[model samples]
Target: MKLSPTYRMPLKRRREGKTNYKKRLALLKSGKPRLVVRKSLRYIRAQIVEFDPKGDKTIVGVLSKELKKYGWNYSFKNLPAAYLTGLLVGKKALERGIKEAVLDIGLHRATKGAKVFVVAKGAIDAGLKVPLGEGILPSEERIRGEHIANYLEKFKNIKEDFEKIKQKILGEMNG
Candidate 1:
């Protein structure tokens, strides 16, 4: 007779592949609040969360949909929208007295210049102290949607709105 392998029921999330315990452990060990960025095919969301024994508490949350109020009329999953969403989150975090945070892209692969870093760049621009390597962020032109200028005949029109929304976010952050 053979014994079955031991199972740790408490970590059901890890066992079922819902959470990555190792990565979560590392982030928690840092003892800094996590700027968790999660993206769906249609939207992106970021939250500043503090680890707690009872349960992680979210200090601030920002969603791409909020851009609609800032005069953004474009795809929420695009680069510009991602940046704006991050900026929104960062500004809120700063308002709530959160000066710094560690990026937590849970279960997401680290691809250079991906949406994750784009969000980080936005947060940094909003004056949040999120530590990130300069090399990891997408180019400023891309973040500003200028890279598509070459092929998009509609770029001129959409680019104007992009600048407008970016400025709106900055103005809001300052005011």
Candidate 2:
């Protein structure tokens, strides 16, 4: 008998059951806070949540979209933007007294060379330890390449002197 194609396909359901289960178990086991990351096509957000089964509480949360008003252009879908988001979130968490956290990546698989990893690196650079080394990618090469190759094609002749701006961003990433 032939089976339907949908039968073999993985349904879009709460795959987080396993990851969340492991996260809660780890949180309970280690008694450490959770640093959760959620990403989208346009933006990425992070939160440091303290799991208290007995109470309705989210310890602290940082959304990158809020950083736009501070002049963070999130339209650039590259390592630099991802890193900045991570840095902003990490700094906010640190300001709220979150020194360390277990990186709970939710349902997303932790790939080695991926945008999410870039964000993790940014967060790490901003001082949140995630069992990873200093997370700053050489912004000069990556950002410059992305701007000239990806961004320039769509928005021609932007007024923001690309080279100088790239150098400045690279400096910020490095520093």
Tell me the whole-model lDDT of each prediction, alpha carbons only. Answer: 0.88, 0.60
lDDT of 2 by residue, 1-175 (tens): 7666645533334343444555457655766776777777776777777767794256766565664554545354555566666676677677777888776677777665456666666667677776554342344445334654555665433223334443443455456
Model 2 steric clash pairs: none
Query: Which run of 10 residues does model 1 get worst, by summed lDDT?
Result: 149-158
State the RMSD for candidate 2.
Answer: 7.5
Q: Provide C-alpha RMSD values for all models, in order.
A: 2.1, 7.5
User: Candidate 1 — which residues are off by over 4 angstroms?
Assistant: 1-10
TM-score of 1: 0.91
* Per-candidate TM-score against the hidden true structure: 0.91, 0.64
Candidate maximizing TM-score: 1
